[model samples]
Target: MENAKSMEYWLQESALICEFMVFGALAAAIFVAVKFERFWSRGRGKREDYVYDNVLWRPCWRALHPAGLMAYRAIVFLFMAVVLAFDLHNGGIHIYYFYTEWTFTLVIIYFGLATLISAKGCRQLAKNDSIRNQDVRANFLKTDLEQEAHVTESPGKNLDGDSVKLQSHQEREEQKKRAGFWGYAMQIIFQTCAGAVMMTDIVFWFIIVPFLTNEHFRLNPLMGSMHSVNALFLVIDAALNSMSFPWFRGAYFVLWTALYVVFQWILHACGLTWWPYPFLELSTPWAPLWYFGLAIVCLVCYTIFTFLIKAKEKNFPKWFPYAYQRLH
Candidate 1:
């Protein structure tokens, strides 16, 4: 009995130490992400590449159009919404007690926001095309009149036209550099969804489904597809979109998990005895190991997605030169 007591004491102490270590790691990662973002944005006064075109423009391929992208986003958003509604109907509203539901809902929100942006972008594209057509007609008439005059254009007129063109180009550059609030929000949500989706699916398939045998937690068709569909839809969108996947944004992903963990803690404090994931239970001596492993897994999941995006950017252009437009 004395030895058991001693072991219990040491286990509690070690779990405290592990908790501190995990908190420290999260804090350090957030600090690094903030510092990196500041360092990059220092001289530019704005994010250099977080441009409107990244979200607004369609793939440069002749077959792709902004309207088609909008339609795709809308379809995914509606489908996910329907799935979420059905899940709630089948599993009850308490299904949200799981992180899977949270991440799935986030992905749905992302597609909804993406659909709106793409629709707005499509309208803007049409308006710009109309303006371009009108300018082309005006320029053709002006050139024809100049040619008919049989008079040489003055050097001053040529210089003025050149100056106007240069100023217009500069204005467009400024516009591109200035990403508005919605643009930043879209990018943040995209990165967060990428990491969260990957982690949720990984944990569900490899860890939770295989080990959990309880009738309540048994994997069904709806539950099983929920685990996979989130990642599938996200990957398809990522393949089609021009948005960038910066490594620094993985910090947001870490913060996202941190928020979920804190939420679970709150729920447990409020008389909830059950743990959504068994590893999250803190009563055991090995709880620290589980927490540490979880942190590592989260980082690994984010890194895997990051590497995939990097690979896509590097290889897609060479493989599908006509269809894939490189974001970088």
Candidate 2:
């Protein structure tokens, strides 16, 4: 009976593998077909000094009003946190032992960081307000003022009220420049978290959950939706934020997966009895094939998201009358 059950389990796993492989290959083909040249070349193919473009979009992403963006971040942060709490409640804190939970948690941290940074950037301004240009100009002004200070050769130049006010402005500008560290950190975190979120959630929903039905692992409705919810939260965040999804940062996605795989291997070396997903088990002779297949899936996942964001930029103006046209 034990041997018969083992045979049945392997049969079910085989069926799941075939189903996911066929579907994934077809979907990847369709996704790549949207912009064939980009995939062939791994990018838009313009040579540049940086691996990724400095400006995510042409006119700059900061054009989006910070107040709206802040509110969006807060909402996303709250929603994901609540869902995460619910998931933990259902499965116990041991849930974090899984990559899906950890990746989703990383996204929550991304939003938490985003909310705080946006609030700082907004500076009690209204929804339509953004000080991006003002801040940039202030930095330039501060630089000029410092240069002038070094060049001042007069023994004592008597300053008027205007000079005092200008000096005060320069001081504030320097402070503003110092506060910009969070904003830069926010950009890198956002880019890395976006790809990681998509990869984790997509694989769970499309591939892992389906096979787990027959295994000891079982996905309830909420668990099933967790993947989709994670994706939805990040996609909405991207749409509303002033950030662009740069394709070259796909390196981050690769790094994120490598870290997870390494973690699993470590667990296995320490005598863990099983793998989280069937394909991840390195004990089999076909382990390399499974690894290569999953790598292809990861590329496809990133490509699909890249297309989605670019499509939003390309089509938003056509669909929405006023605000969409002003997004960038």
Candidate 3:
């Protein structure tokens, strides 16, 4: 009996140690991320590095239009929303207590935000094309007038050329500049979701669904797809969209998970009796190992996604020079 009591004491102490370590690591990551972001913003980073073509949807083929991308986002958002609603109706508000629900909802929010951004981008593209066409027609008329003057032996001072060149230069600079506030928000959210969906799906399929499924944690089609579909949709979106994924953004993913952990702690403090994931329970001596392992998993997953983005950038231009838009 004394041994059992001693083990319990050690387990509690170990859990506290694990919790502090996790938070400390997260804090360090956030500090580094902020420092890097500030450094990059202060003109040390390439403008293209800070800028992303989130508004444009460059497909694998030229035939697919940006509108098609917007449509795709809308459809995805609607489908995910329906699935989420159905799950909530069946499972009640308590489903929000799971990390799966939080990640799934974040995916839904991304698609919705992406849809709006894409639509706005497409509209802007159309308007610019229309203005360019009008300018072409006007220039054609001016060119004819100059030709007629040349035939009549009259001098024509074409002062518009220099102004036209200056105007085009300004426009190009505007294009190269970063897309505004919403664009960055979408990009950050995209990176955050990338790491999160990966972690959620990996833990759910290989860990929870296999070992933890019981009367209280039953697996169903909707629940299973909740784990898989988020990643599938995100992967497809990444392939279609023209956005650069930077490794530094992994800090946001870590912070996101840390926030969820803090939320769970708050709930537990308020008399919640159960943990959503078994590894999260602090009653075992293995809690520190589990916590540390998950931190490593989070880093690994983010690195995997960043590698995929790099691969896409390297290969897409070689394979589809005309169709693939380069983010850099």
By lDDT, who's the top model here?
3
lDDT for 211 (candidate 3): 85
Query: Any residue pairs clashing in model 3, and if so which?
Result: none
Residue-level lDDT tens digits of model 3 in 112-199: 9889888887787687668766766676677678878677633333335634764586457645756677777787889999999999
lDDT of 3: 0.77
- How close is each model in CA RMSD to the real structure? 5.1, 11.0, 4.3
lDDT of 2 at 39: 27
Residue-level error in angstroms, candidate 3, position 43: 7.5
Name the lDDT value of residue 156 in candidate 2. Answer: 24
> Candidate 1 residues 1-328, lDDT tens each?
1122233533566546655765776797687566655334442323433545544446434477878878988999999999999989988989988999999999999999888878777787677667656665666667667756856765345335644675576436534554467767777788899999999999988888788647558878988899998999988887788777767778878888877876776676565667788787666767788888888889899888888778888898888888776543
Sorted by lDDT, highest first, which candidate order results?
Answer: 3, 1, 2
In TM-score terms, candidate 1 sits at 0.84
Q: Per-residue lDDT for 177-287 in model 2, tens only?
A: 322445545555666667777788777777776655456468677777777777887787767653555565565566666667666656655556666776776445565
Total backbone clashes of model 1?
0
lDDT score of residue 139 within candidate 2: 54
TM-score for candidate 2: 0.63
Query: Each candidate: what lDDT?
Result: 0.74, 0.61, 0.77
